[model samples]
Target chain A: MARWLLISVIYIELIIVSLGTSSVAQGGQELDWAALDWKALDWEALDGWELEGEAFAQARYFPDNPLYIGQHSQNQSLALELSAYRKFSDSFSLEFIPFYRHDFQDDERSHLDIRKAYALWASPTLEIGAGINKVFWGVTEAVHLVDIINQTDAIEAPDQEEKLGQAMVSLSLPLPSGLFDLYLMPNFRERNFPGEDGRLRGALVVDTNNPLYEHKDKDHHIDWAARLKQSLKDGELALSYFEGTARDPNLIMPLGTPSPVLLPYYSQIKQLGLEGQYIKDEWLWKLEAIYRKGQPNLQFEVEDYYAMTGGFEYNIYSIFESSQDLGIILEGIYDQRRDNALTFNEEDIVLGTRWSLNNMHSTEVLGLWIQDADSSAHNFVLELSTEIGNSIAVTVEALIFSEQQRNSDSGRFTADSIGHQMRQDDYLQIEIGYFF
Target chain B: MRNNLSNPPFHFLASILLMIPLLVQAETAEQKGRAIFEEIDRRDLNFGDFSSDQEMILRNKSGQESRRIMENTVLEGGNKDINDGDKTLIIFREPKRIRGTALITHAHQQRDDDQWLYLPALGRVKRISGASKAGSFVGSEFSYEDLAPQEVDDYTYEYIGDEIFAEQDCFKVKRVPVDKDSGYTQQFVWVDKSEYRIQKVEFYDRKATLIKILTITSYQQYLDQYWRPGYLSMINQQDGKSTDMIATNYVFRQGLTEADFSENSLRRAR
Candidate 1:
């Protein structure tokens, strides 16, 4: 079975390469280099220290939200992450990161997580690592269609930026045409969601513990993922394949007490992804596409489909006579399932802008709007962040959901879907983070 | 390593004689400015490649300050048909949250420079769009347009006469930005005639009003060829804010290739 998986991975990679060859025409300027986002912590207070890494603790709060509260709820959380590594030998070492969380709103949302615990042996041209880690792959900003390695931690944030750790044995080797990465993921992890009384909770309660997998091995299934990334003269191209259980679960309405419970069905899948982007002066064009041979939707039929997203970002510097920049981004998302697509972004448009103040405080703002083409459904998000003193930073975020398809004939088709189900989840979030 | 343009006419009697036509005939003020700018640009272009450590210290009106440390690597790009500009990569090392973040700049002599930002936390590379050149360089007083390799063609120069400033004979040159989208309308530069080094610069706003001033305090010669400044302070004339930069640890010719500045190698830049 491993041999078969490897063979099919190679075959699919070849097809993707062939299809991408014609489109890989040229390259452009690689500016956006040296760009600084002050939102990232700067340890100036501990400057000139010989340490090779950094650590930070942050706290988050929700000033306003339309949700029922539980006893002792404070609608706040304190989280911290420390990323430090030690080299025992010259070329071998260990990396461990322990993250802590405490949520005043929900106890289930607070827990200690081992984000990365790995031992690595690296050389000039080859590298090998084993343990739990997170891998990210995708190009576009608004949505990530090709990043499928880690399961989403929904309770952490709705932006899908939080990922659960995955255990794996990974290897990277230099190929003649590009760099190749091979992975043997030994454990399957299900996505996490907020509890009933927690903020950002879904309409139906999610049963994360009793996930039903297509394979009887359940979490013991040995999954596989491979990627070939080539750096072109003007741009970059990557082709990847993953044969594993799906990270996203299909919701099943199991008959219980009829309080609307969601049973997660984890299906086995074979996925192929292609991503490419070019950097031009004052503009960047990006594209991502994925084909999957498994059930990604609520229904278990057809067993095959594809989804794609493409967009470009243009910049306008020194706006309104200030030495700041405003970057405009636009992307169109499409899925083969079209209107029936489970993903809320299918047949939708993403319009966003990024503002950089270029001050010492690294003041920045990002605004995004996701609009459904078939209906008047839309999701809007805004994030504004700045630094306070040397070690502390503040960020404010607001989310709005307007589901025109709610409770009507047009809303019935969108009922229980991502956008409609999230109609009342709009919230205002404020976070003040301190770094050490 | 000085280019021919940097060699003043006073160095040779024959070259001074060649310039007699300009003084005696139709020598526009702009021509004189171009001549002086060419000399400054030539003296500035030395060394093949180098790396250094940089600190940006920002202070508000209240005198409270914040600092950032980064490793900067630069590769000269004139000989390979890329014109006489250079490529620069800056990696933030001190910031705990932004550790391993890298930014690349591909500067050109004729067109607008390009920029790419790599966020290590997200493991992603993104291109910065819009008039990026006019944007600030990481919240510092120095704008991206100010840090670019000031190629001769990117500006129109004029000789503003010579005077003794900073106790040295200096040529005051007025440079008008050729790029239409430049944040600065014009800049007044004072270069020491003997060393061809820029001593002070005054920036005019987009409306051609004086806005900021940059002063270079000290310089150190590396590889016995490149003259790099050790301290620079930029003051905003309108606001009370300022930024001071301390550049240190200059290592030249550690064998950096053009490939070293590419996005592929940027992941491990630190």
Candidate 2:
């Protein structure tokens, strides 16, 4: 297993080196050089502190969701985060962030993760960085299935199963027609158990501001990304890739087992996304689509998978003089799995409304119906969020889930068929935050 | 009884004569208050050649005094286009900290006005948009719009009533916002009994909330004809910030021009 993992790690590194060198040769741009104007870094341009940070306490209670492992299981979780950033100069600054999350049920564990801790050197045409960072790639509202090429979460989950952190160097260049960003990261495992291997990662992301109509001045944008694991936006797009292996591919296997250990597989994921939004007076409409392939971690089996997702959202405000806004969302996903078995498909419909009582207070109600290969569920959520003062905010959420189907082990029903009968679950969450 | 019925016209004339004194007294007070209010308006319109010294105390939402400062400046004209070929400048001299910083704003009667802010740190001037006038200025209790020259034609005013303010008789006038986008819905002003100068003005937001209060104190006669408020303070009810404008020097000169209001000229202003 160790040999297999080592081989996989080496292969990934070779691929990354070859791709990065070729792109660099073709583009003729140095990855480590920083070309930023220092005069742009005047602190006075920011004026009034421009310093903001927030801390919050949140609790979630989930009851009887079809995706749970057992007949019924409930979990409670708590999380806290703090962040601070100050501009030393207009083009350079230092930022620090510390975060912690603890789960009370089941595993009963806690983890502290640094979401962002770095110094940034930025100019109108370039940006350079060092430390923990996040990259944004897609423009979808509900679920950005195509944004998988980057190292950030496109889904709703606040925690990432893969703790991906690396010593990274990035560069941003503004082209005459578009923006190009690239990144190069070296892998150093802080906690890799035996039989697990780790390697370097790199990525590139490109965004083009293009307009579909001649009369409109570029309301639409397109993003393309390719990476070894995932890279954030504003890095490099052409000369970037990821080269890393799973930490523990053979968790419980003996040291010298004859059984072939899961080979560390080197994979390259690529993504393409497009988005357009139009706003006329009080009416807003948006449409987005994304496509992703070669997601190794997303594979349920030994083979890789690909997914394509698209969604649309519309908002109409003050339709009846009640200061009310109506929003509707629709999303669809197609997932191609390995082994030519158990393909995943998802479709969702969401309807929501927001009522503005004043500038400082608002209430929202949302109804969502999600259908997947194994189950279908309906969720109704209501949220009331208000700013009590300049630095204090409170939000309360009530959610009720209705599972329409249950999975059975009789082999008489397929996973897709069982998903049709999944029934409902319920949950509640509340959060209060303060900023200074 | 028969003789009284025949002389009914004479009896009615006597009754009319008796009511004249009461009517005269009511009319006189109204006339006095209106004159004072109009004089205050005129002085504010032609506000030039006046200066004073003042101190401002700012409190936060937690009822803590966050800052205190003393300032002095000279006022030119209250017209929005005072710098437009008029060459009027309001120069600050005291408060060692903010000394030499000038706020140069050009007002236009019908269109949006332009403002130039000169900061000591940058040693350069920045042009600010007129759109921001709707909000509070530098966290002060008064909006930037309130600090600018207000055209009397922008609002239709009504003489509501007479009352006593700060131990002095005054006239209460009501003014409504005629601009559709004004953040304020209405304003109530009180004029002093003797000087025809505004003593207080209360501003209400669109939601009918009392958002700001302006009080004028310490009056002085300029050019022996124009009465000017030596000190003026505005308190923001929501944020608890206050701004006091004190005049320290007064000079009357006809040496300004409209050519000075151009954007290019503002960048080159000394």
After the best TM-score superposition of candidate 1, give how far the Cα of residue B165 lies from its true spot, in angstroms: 2.2
Instruction: State how far residue A364 of model 2 sits from its true place (Å).
Output: 6.0
DockQ, computed on Cα atoms, for candidate 2? 0.03
Q: Can you write out model 2's per-residue Cα lDDT over A194-263, one digit (the tens) per residue?
A: 1111001001111111101111211121222332211121111222223232221211212463542322
What TM-scores do the predictions have? 0.80, 0.44
Judged by DockQ, which candidate is best? 1
Local lDDT at A12 for model 1:
55
Q: Which stretches of candidate 2 lie over 4 Å from their true place?
A: A1-57, A63-76, A84-86, A106-109, A149-167, A175-178, A185-267, A295-345, A359-376, A386-394, A404-425, A432-436, B1-270
**Which residues of candidate 1, in runs, are more than 4 Å off?**
A1-74, A86-94, A118-131, A169-182, A228-237, A255-260, A278-280, A404-416, B1-46, B61-64, B79-85, B93-97, B110-112
Cα distance off (Å), candidate 2, residue B96: 33
List lDDT for all candidates, in order: 0.73, 0.45
